[model samples]
Target: MAKVAIVMGSDSDMPIMKKAAEFLDQMGIDFEMTIISAHREPDIFFEWAKGAKDRGVKVIIAGAGKAAHLPGMCAALFPMPVIGIPMKTSDLGGVDSLYSIVQMPSGIPVATVAINGGLNAGILAAKILATSDEKLLEKLEAYSEEMKQSVVEKAEKLDKVGYKDYE
Candidate 1:
């Protein structure tokens, strides 16, 4: 069974949603990806959200642009964590999407990432899962160390060759 479910309102959201899927893949986490629009296909959306828990989905990442209610609605239906990725839209520069997902009412809350922040959402999902899975915790710790090392390497190179010429 998949541990994570990545959903989007449209195929256009795939470029962003793919980042989350890639991260989950790197973490050796199983996930399912699909397109489900809350507005266009309400019944299908409802069924997918309702059956997610039984399908062994521990976390959900939903990406939507304008009027981004997919994540919020998924949170309403699922008891587990739902991370909302606000895609950059042609209008309002995605602020609209960001606000729509983040402004859920009391009791129902969705963890929101920045606009086009699917990668961060994926990392957060991994961290959430790590809280209970020791193996995942180890992988996360190692990944963190690797990132720190990359930064250190970059800094060393910058020190060797000043910022003006630095690539």
Candidate 2:
């Protein structure tokens, strides 16, 4: 049973949404991914969103560009946490998509991240799930330590090599 549902409006979002999947994989979180356009196929999307909870999906990470209704629609139908990733668009540089997800009406809230922020979305989803699972919480803590160590290693190299020699 998947705890997270990773959905996007189109395949073009694969590049961005893959980051979320990669992070979830590292955290040992199971997720079901699919491309479902809320506008083009409302019936299918609606059914999927409504049945997500029954299917064991506790969180949803939705990526969409342009109008970006996928995330908001999922939030509206699914009674769980929804994290929206606004893909960068060539037209407005994803401002349109960002606004659409963030400006959701009262009583319906979609937690949105920056344009193309799939990794953060995945981390946020993991944090939400970790509230009830001690093992997952420990994994999250170790992940944070790993990230901190990576930065420390980079900083040490930069200090030793100096800015000119660092690459």
Each candidate structure's count of clashing pairs: 0, 0
**Which model scores highest in lDDT?**
2
lDDT of each: 0.96, 0.97
Candidate 2 lDDT tens digits, 36-74: 999999999999999999999999999999999999999
What digit string (tens of lDDT, one per residue) describes model 1 on residues 22-57?
A: 999999999999999999999999999999999999
Q: Give candidate 2's error at residue 143 in angstroms.
A: 0.8
How does model 2 score by TM-score? Answer: 0.98
